[model samples]
Target: MSHSKHSSLSHDRHPLNFQDTYICPICRHGHIESLTLMDVFACDFCRHIFTANLKDQSIHVENSSQPMTWRWTGRNWQAANQLDVDLTVVIWLVSVSLVILPPSLIWLSSHAFPPLVGSSGSWFPAFWVGLTFTLHFLFVSWLMAEHYQFPLYVSTKVRLRRLLDRR
Candidate 1:
């Protein structure tokens, strides 16, 4: 009875078949299939096209006109030409500029022409000045990030962990 049950279970449909499914490097999905074009594979999950190199026996993912070659780093695929910039650095620089520029300008303007501005008795309070600076800083930072193609945030914890590893 045990042998019969085992045989029946083996014949049943399995979730994965090794021969048909290929693992996708981009999404880590296993539903990649070869397209009609020879040496080309497409991952529906990630919507990425992959080209198979026969000589090297490696898969290349198409990134625009240039194909970015990736290598399996034991566990994950890493692109050979990864040009990622640290967004934290950009944000830090922008924040520092915002903190310094507006206050300095306000001080300089008031000092340069004290009688005209100060005698008017219409100076903004500290809270309003700070609020205006904050709003302006946020808008400028967002615009700069969008214009320069910089991400607002990136997960660099993995890279930091790797660097901190002693062994």
Candidate 2:
């Protein structure tokens, strides 16, 4: 069984985005049939068919509907991941510089040691501050990614078409 239905109730009536259009069952290609409330669309092209039940919003596609072509619109997740990683690295660098480096330099200057080679006592506070900032940034980034669906929205499109004879 397909995980998602090809139709969207939001786009009813228009031919391009018709919610209840009938398609051929054999070839998985759309047929010329105009769908009505009583009729289920059947693909004549590739042994696919589907219908929406009136009483309860149930979308039923027959066994033949298994092999129908599925299309989708969304960002490529792998590409998005690459971009996320880049962003993460940039953030990490910024955090190290702004949060970790400056304070360490100040604390080091207070003691008798090199600014870059951080003193022992200064290490503790620096570590804590860096850890806290990193954790906080990570959490904010995670929340933003979740809320925004991290890069893009993922959606699918399926249609039934007639299996025409090529010979």
Candidate with maximal TM-score:
1
* Candidate 2 Cα outliers beyond 4 Å, as residue runs: 1-15, 18-119, 152-167
TM-score of 2: 0.25
Error of 2 at 27 (Å): 28
lDDT of 1 at 91: 65
Per-residue alpha-carbon lDDT of candidate 1 for residues 1-167, written as tens digits (9 for 90 to 100)? 34432432344432322123355665553335677645576765555677765355456767434445655343334555454467657866877787678866776665665544455454554444567677877777665544432212111322345468755
**Model 1 whole-model lDDT (C-alpha atoms):** 0.53
Q: What's the TM-score of each model vs. the native?
A: 0.37, 0.25
RMSD of 1: 13.3
